[model samples]
Every structure is written in C-alpha cells, then in structure tokens.
Target: MHKNVYTADNAAMLLIDHQVGTIGWTKSHDVEEIKKNAILLAKIATAVGMPLVLTSSMEDNAQGPLLLELDETAPEAFAARIKRAGIVNAMDDENFNSAVKATGRKKVVVAGITTEVCVVFPVLQLLDEGYEVQVVTDASASFTKIGDDAALRRIEQAGAVITSTSQIVSELAVDWTMPKGQALGKLLNLGA
Candidate 1:
C-alpha cells in the first residue's frame, strides 16, 4: 500500500452530520452535488467492505435528520450510526469517538455537513490522535464558500489530507479488475 494513499484495507469512513437541516443551509456546494458525492462515498465504503460510521446531531430539532438515502445506501452502517445529542464535536461525544475507534482502522475518510464545525472539530481530534484523516470537501459543505475554504485550510495545515470523493474512489480502487475497483467502476459508470 502507498504511504500517503488510503486504500480500502487501511481506511474506514466517517460520515458526519449530513442532516436535513444542516444540508438545507449549506452554501459551499449545491445541495444535490453534496448529496451525490456523499451517497457515492457511502456506496464505495459498502462495496469495498470498508468499515463505516455515520453520525448525526439533535435530529429532532433544527438538525432535522440524517439523509435517508444514506441509510438506504449503507444500511448496516446506518444501523450502527452514532446519534449525538447536540455534541458540536463528534469526537467529544463518547459514543461517536468510541465508534470510530472500534473500527480499528487508522485512516479515516471524513465528510460532513457544515464543514467548519461538524467536520473540522472531530477531524482535528482525529489528527491529534494519529489517524490519517482525509476530508472529502465536495461531500462536506459550509454556510459559505469562505467558511468551507477556511475549514479546509485549517485541516490541511494540521496534517489532514484534503481530498474529494473521486480521488478517494481512484485510490481505493487502484486496479480496475479488482473486486473493489470493479464495484467502484460500476458505480461511476466506468464500464467495469
């Protein structure tokens, strides 16, 4: 495995706070685009058998609820998702932090709604804990482009890898003939 790349074997996915209320306010990317990218990442995790952990915050209120499509896309992960009770930083929530730790994978592919807080907070903690963090920018968004860019810069400067859904797919699926590669290719309509 390449030292800098997170292949399927070395990585797990943490999809955070992609809730209806949060996504409805994101301005960094089109809502549909964010949904598409996030859903694809979830599918990739499932296809490659990568451990996945989903998280949400205060689903009963303004946070609304996690995207239902995510549950449909990766049902097993959805079943085990961490429903945080207003924890701004998911890592600060014991259950959420424990869930990620339980994956037993050192590299984490992360995406979330409202990049500045929901994504950046746990990401920083994950980095400090020695995990290789990959932030899928397109799949994560903020209330403004400036906020999103600032969050990306902060994580990048602190040793996290700033990435996109497509880059992640390519790295995890390094060979088109491999089962993971083939599954990802089919998802991307690349004629597996």
Candidate 2:
C-alpha cells in the first residue's frame, strides 16, 4: 500500500476530548449527531481491527469522561486511553504521543471535541511530524459553525485531509464483499 493512501494497514484512529462537558457546548453540529458519528467511527475502527487511541482534556474536572458509547465500542485490546495531566493538545502529552507512535501506522484518522482546539492542535503537530493525517469533520464539533469552518481551513492549509466519517469508512473498506466492509456498511446504515 502507498504511504499516502489511508488503507487500514497504514491508518489508525485517534479520538480526543469527546466528553460530555465539551460536547454539550458544541454549536457546529447537533450534539446527538456528533455522539452517533463518534460511536460509529469507533465501531468501524474496532470491526476493521484498526489501532485506536483516545485522550481527554481535564476529564477530572469540567470535561467529564469520554462518551459511554465510545468507551464501550472501542476495543480494549486495540485501544489505549491516554491520561494527560493538563495538556490541551494530546500530541504534547508524552503518553498520548507514544501511544500513537506505538501503533506503527503513519496515517491517523483524527476526531475530537472543540475542533478549533483539541482536534486541530494535535493535527497540525502530527502533520509537522510528517504523518499523513485525516480529520473526520462530522465526528468533531466546535463552539460555533464559524470556529469549525476556520479550524478545518487551517488544517487543510497545513496539508491534512479534511474528510467525513462515511468517506473514511468507505476508503478503509474498499469492497463490500470483505467482512469489514459489510460490518462497516451496516454500522453506517449504508446497507452494503
């Protein structure tokens, strides 16, 4: 597989700060929709046997814990939830960065709450480190539509792929005959 392509062999999923407190404030997308997309992404990643990393910002305080659906859907064996002290950017936290590096995959499918901050910060850094990054736009949210739009623009300007959850799932599956493909299609209600 080409390094530039986000095949299952080369891509991993990174979720950040999808907590109740932050999600409740999201204005760019419907809160329920964000939760659904996040859960769907997690389920797809799990079904495809992809490496997954999760992180939360200030979960002990205002952020609350990761959404229960994600927590339950993400595979425990293939996923690691990094506990950061106070780093807003998961890439800055040693544990989170190490978890991502340990995945041995260069392309990351990333999503998070507050697209302008938690999601974009680490995405820019990951791009700087020469990793191919794709941001799952629907799986992430911002305080306002303007904030989400601007953040996506910044990420694209930095050379990251700005894509949607369904697009990523399709790219990973490639063919409906494959078991992962069938599973993903069902999860996304695509009826493949």
Cα-based TM-score, every candidate = 0.98, 0.95
Q: Worst 10-residue stretch by lDDT in candidate 2?
A: 74-83
Off by over 4 Å in 2: 1-3, 75-79
lDDT by residue for model 1 (100-177), tens:
999999999999998998999999999999999999998999999999999999999999999889899999999989
How much does each candidate deviate from the true structure in C-alpha RMSD? 0.8, 1.6
Q: What is the lDDT of residue 166 in candidate 1?
A: 89
Question: Candidate 1, after superposition: displacement of residue 24 in Å?
Answer: 0.4
Which residue pairs collide in model 2, if any?
none
Scored by lDDT, model 2 comes in at 0.87
lDDT by residue (tens digit), candidate 2, 1-192 = 544668777789998888888899899999998988888888878888888888887778888878877767874832468867779888999999998999999889999998998999999999999898999999999999999999999999999999998899889888887887898888877788
**lDDT for each candidate structure:** 0.93, 0.87
Model 1: lDDT of residue 1: 60
